[model samples]
Target: MSTLSADLAHQPGPETVAEGLLTMLAVVPVCLLVAGYGRGVQELWARRGAGQIVPPWRVAAFGVGVLTVLAAEQGPAHELAESSFAGHMTQHMLFLLVAGPLLAAGGAGLPLTLAAPVPLRRLLARWRVTPAVRRLRRPTTYALLAGGGQSIVLWFWHLPEPYTAAVDHPVTHTAEHLCFLAAAWSFWAPVLGPPRHRAPAPVAVLALVGTMLPASALGAVLTLAPAPVYPARVFGADPLADQQLAGLLMWAPMDLVVLVVTLTVFLRWLRQLDRDRPAGLPRTATLPGTAAVPASAATEGERR
Candidate 1:
């Protein structure tokens, strides 16, 4: 405790809160622009009686995701993250695991594309089927790029040198966050995004579980390690405690999120299977301990 207190006492003063506030200023305008543009597109398409280009619920979902991001990035957490490892972890988890998924689930891609100008739209349409995109659209690619990539990035930046550098250098920190967010969005595509290119629920489920492995391992290692790897000495808390908190933050929340949503995915999977089944196939219960048998087989049973 004394060692921790001593470290805290030597801390430097914070930059003006205005720095965080300035970021908030940027976030608000961008969110408004997105929402307004989406609404405008929806209205334009609706007026033509051509149906909506972007659904209202999706825009609302996207707005929610954006607002959640702003709260994580520009709120006190952003400032505290600079000083406290736990705070930093909270921000990262919120952005990469929570808000990013919400944004993807909202299918912001559709609205953003629809909102683009005609020239850009034509370019995008041409690019949609390009070989590079087709390759990236593969389910295995989503698992590798999003699930594997995010895990690697999360672990890589937490290494002692990288952690120290990000804490010490603003640009490095920004890059770290951008990398995290990008990887996270990529990872979530199978589950939430590029809706037209959805991976099978089973595959998406496996990817989600596989993605949890590295992050959980890293968290466990950090939680059990003898010393802190982060540059938390100048911060106002015990580095050891802070590191443990950060580890727990990394370990539990994402897995819980996956667990809850995987259940939803499973139910959806069952429903999807039911829909895709041949017309007379017997439906299976989504819950365990139920078997599906052919209705015709049952109907013609002669005790055989």
Candidate 2:
């Protein structure tokens, strides 16, 4: 026991202690979410049996999302982000594209609902039908609000004035991350979240495509700039090169991520359409050696 204690315990400096505390703070929300989800899963398992509430893939996606957030906010990535424009862009992309969508698709909303107290759940149900809530829930309203919100947040934070402030200050930096994550989550929820909260696939597609325009434009501006926009945050000896690389990172990877997600949503929508179709309602039939029979002809034959 003494040997174990000695081996396990070591003196940590102030910087190490602060980093540990910040890491712990980052972990708190994830832990709370997991706990709530676990409780909900337990109840669901009792009522509906195992693996019926949330799909395995969704659970895996949530885990990956959590990992992505930790990686972006906590260790080497965070360190790199402090000094490098490209690294910061990489972290932001992970938050926006990977973590946000994956978490939304993980279907945690229902689980969290299930985890809430009965009184709170009842309150939420009542609130759901309120005018303000209904308006916010509208597909078009949410799509526009979400996309617009994310675009504004992204552009504002990337501006040299605000970006420099964020880099220089801890509180501003924290706020920047929160803004990015919240905007991203809002932008994706209607497309990827619980089915009850989701919007039509067409609407989601349009929202995503619209968002891409501004994002790509920003990236293009950075890539084509004559000099470094963020001189203090440059990592490499060639600041211009670093900024250009950062811009390219945002351009290519973000666009690819959006395209992939759009395709996934479209295909899933197609699948849902096929699934909801009436069974055994054939409009035409063809025998091995015969031409297809039209529905009208078949109906006429039946009438005769």
Candidate 3:
């Protein structure tokens, strides 16, 4: 146990700790602005004889998202990542699968936009329609960019040169982290924040599938390779084992994340259908204290 601990543990850098603290501080103001401004808005509405409580879930989710990023980038994982593949994989999983989706679900951008000064907000809104931004507004294009861009970043960075560069160079490592987070946010936005006019659930599921297959395939290849593909064999641990662990981390855990997210989206889609159904009848009719039956069968049984 001591040996294992030694193999995985490392001295946490002051710089890393500071970076984490700073990151937290950066989000604090934005969150405060949102809450404060929102409350003010509510009060303003109250004066006009109408008001609504702000949704707590969205705020909580955003907080969790920021914390996830903080934990990955500035926590023990970041400190140990250069020395241990497990640590690196831990950070990757947190950002790509967890934080990104949470932020999207929480409406991360909404808070900032709402909190911004009126003129700045107007300017920002206008900027959304630029040619480059317009390209991203299309659902199909958004999904493709998110899934494809993420896959490229994930696979490309894991290559020997880039992987080693990320481990050895601070700038490269920061860039790598940013790219992963950006790709993740892009991928998750369509899944979490879909346009009201279209059914985004199917597209979201497809985007997730697109992400899942490529990531799992990459992990499988890495696992099957006889030797460590990345030159980041820093710790005294067995290189082969470290590499294999990283592969397994990506393989099993990535699928699990995808599966869980897929189920969540599927359930939400089911709920949307329920919401859309007409008031006169339940689509899947169930008699009092009986199993749910298909509408046709239920109607026939009632007739009988």
- TM values, all candidates: 0.77, 0.81, 0.73
**Is candidate 1 or 3 superior in TM-score?**
1
Off by over 4 Å in 2: 1-21, 233-235, 267-304
Which residue pairs in candidate 1 have backbone atoms (N, alpha carbon, C) closer than 3 angstroms, thus clashing? 146-187
Alpha-carbon lDDT of model 3: 0.75
TM-score of 1: 0.77
Q: How accurate is candidate 2 locally (lDDT)?
A: 0.83
Q: Write the per-residue lDDT of candidate 3 for residues 114-225, one digit (tens) a residue.
A: 6567899899989888999877777777776778899999999888889888777666777788888888877787776524312277877887888899999989987788
Task: lDDT winner between 1 and 2, please give it.
Answer: 2
User: What is residue 264's positional error in candidate 2, in angstroms?
Assistant: 3.4
Q: lDDT by residue for model 2 over 53-96, one digit each (tens)? A: 78777778877887888888986888888777888888889888
Clash counts per candidate, in order, are 1, 0, 0
Error of 2 at 139 (Å): 3.4
At residue 285, give the lDDT of candidate 3.
Answer: 72
